[model samples]
Target: MGKTTRDRLLQTLASAFELPEDVVLDLTRITITGNTQFLMENHRGILAYDPEKISLRTDQGETVITGRNLKIDSLFASEIMITGSINGIQFIRSRG
Candidate 1:
């Protein structure tokens, strides 16, 4: 099937389920706690990781996080928890 067809199906499912499109589409969800911790769900994978930087691929784009003493405190198939002195977070749109 084509991308648009799949997208429309997801949208319909979202409406039927009364859920956000991102949730239905398995898009990345991010939550930050102060400058110390970050939680992300529905991520594809970690592209890069280090004490100062971390990058992840998501359905919407690439997510880049910069920080100090960064570490993946917890990791699972659909979720990741990072702890550090976060400096910045950026989302780069995926190129078509």
Candidate 2:
């Protein structure tokens, strides 16, 4: 089946189960804590990384995080955690 059809089915299932689309569809979830820590789930991969900037690809868009002394504390297949003096977060919406 096509992606659209699969997504539609997942949407319906999410609605019927009263579950968030993020849970059912494996959407990206980002959380920030105290401007010092960042966590993301279901992330595709890191596009770029540096001490001052980090970019990641997700299902919805590109996530760009800027900060000072940025460090990746943990990384997994679909989750990542970064810690530093976070200054900004930007989202570039996906065309597809």
Best by TM-score: 2
Residue-wise lDDT of candidate 2 within 1-96, one digit each (tens)?
A: 498799999999999999998989988888899999999999999999999999999987899999999999999999999999999999999887
Judging by lDDT against the true structure, name the best candidate.
2
Candidate 1: residue 45 lDDT (0-100):
92
Cα displacement (angstroms), candidate 2, residue 52, comes to 1.3
Error of 1 at 12 (Å): 5.9
RMSD after CA superposition, every candidate: 2.0, 1.7
Instruction: Give the distance in Å from residue 20's predicted Cα in candidate 2 to where it truly belongs.
Output: 2.5
User: How big is the positional error of residue 9 in model 1, measured in Å on the Cα after superposition?
Assistant: 4.9
Sliding window of 10 residues with minimal summed lDDT for model 2: 1-10
Off by over 4 Å in 2: none
